[model samples]
Target: MQDYLELFFNLIKQPIIQAVLCVIGSILAAKIADWIIGRVLSNLANRTSSTIDDNIIQILHRPIYYSILFIGLGISVKAFSLPEVLSFVLLGLFKTIAVIIWSFALFQSFMHFITWYGRQGKKDNVF
Candidate 1:
């Protein structure tokens, strides 16, 4: 039974340090994204009113949440080491994340366009 259990987990040979490194990378990436979002919102708010600040905050929030989730998943992957079982799942996860990021980018662009159009409409009304 012990041999069988060992055989079950044999694939996950990566060291704790490697997994830790990956987690650290994910965390750093999240923090960097946070700072970027903050700075961008600050700059935009300076340029205009506070209306767009809320949208920027909302857009930035989910990526930070998902980055930490991804780190948890990476740590678990290191422990499970069942690549054969998890390969497809991991692939799907990556694709899902990519889609989410793309969606956020597209949504942000749309919001920016709307704001610009609204501002232009106000100008036209004033003239």
Candidate 2:
């Protein structure tokens, strides 16, 4: 029994297993986040008159989901005792993905706000 328990512990400590676990955990987290955003946040956004909130919510949904995924992936990659160059490259790739996703989301939100502002101005005859 003791030997079996030791072997199990050793297997669990393997880098590949740890990485897979991290990915699975991240995926589950992303799903939960998506569910909350789709059901609860969307309902709240719909209750409001302005569509700006809705747009913001829409812009945020995917980036937030991907961010969680990337975070998990980064952690998983770091769990492996990778060589310095490979580790650096992988971490950099994950960071780049995060930056791109967030920047795109912000750009989209900005565009939506500008459109809404323009509509308001037109309605008020300010422009």
Candidate 3:
């Protein structure tokens, strides 16, 4: 038993193994998050009268998934310990991706809000 444990620990210590595990874990985590959001929170949101909750839920999927993926990729990059220039470029790319994901989500949420507001105004005869 102790020998098996030691072997397992040794295997986990390798950088490549660590990187792979981190990536796999991140993917699983993101999937779990998506499931929870889609199955659990979605039901809760559906119970509400407002479309805003539903729209917000829909907007959240990409940012959440990409954020998790980027975090894993960043960790894996460090584990590999490549050239400084390469590492810097890779990290920058990841950051850019993250920023784009969140920015699009924000833009989409804002659009949904505007649409809802317009409908409200129309219903109230205020527009």
Show pairs that collide, candidate 1: none
lDDT of each: 0.66, 0.94, 0.91
For residue 68, model 2's alpha carbon misses the true position, in angstroms, by 0.5
Q: How much is 92 displaced in model 3, in angstroms?
A: 0.9
lDDT of 1 by residue, 1-127 (tens): 9998786566335555456556667777777776766777556666766455566665656666576657656565655455765856884686589578858866886787688778878978953
What lDDT tens digits, residue by residue, belong to model 3 across residues 38-73?
889889999999899899998988799889889888
Relative to the unseen true structure, what is the C-alpha lDDT of residue 95 in candidate 3, on a scale of 0 to 100?
Answer: 97
lDDT of 2 by residue, 6-35 (tens): 998998899998988999999999999999
Those runs of model 2 whose alpha carbons end farther than 4 Å from true positions after fitting are 1-8
The TM-score of predicted model 1 comes to: 0.53
Which one wins on TM-score? 3
Q: Flag the better candidate by lDDT, 1 or 3.
A: 3
Q: What RMSD does model 2 have?
A: 1.9
Better of 1 and 2 by TM-score: 2
Count clashing residue pairs per candidate. 0, 0, 0
- Rank by lDDT, descending? 2, 3, 1
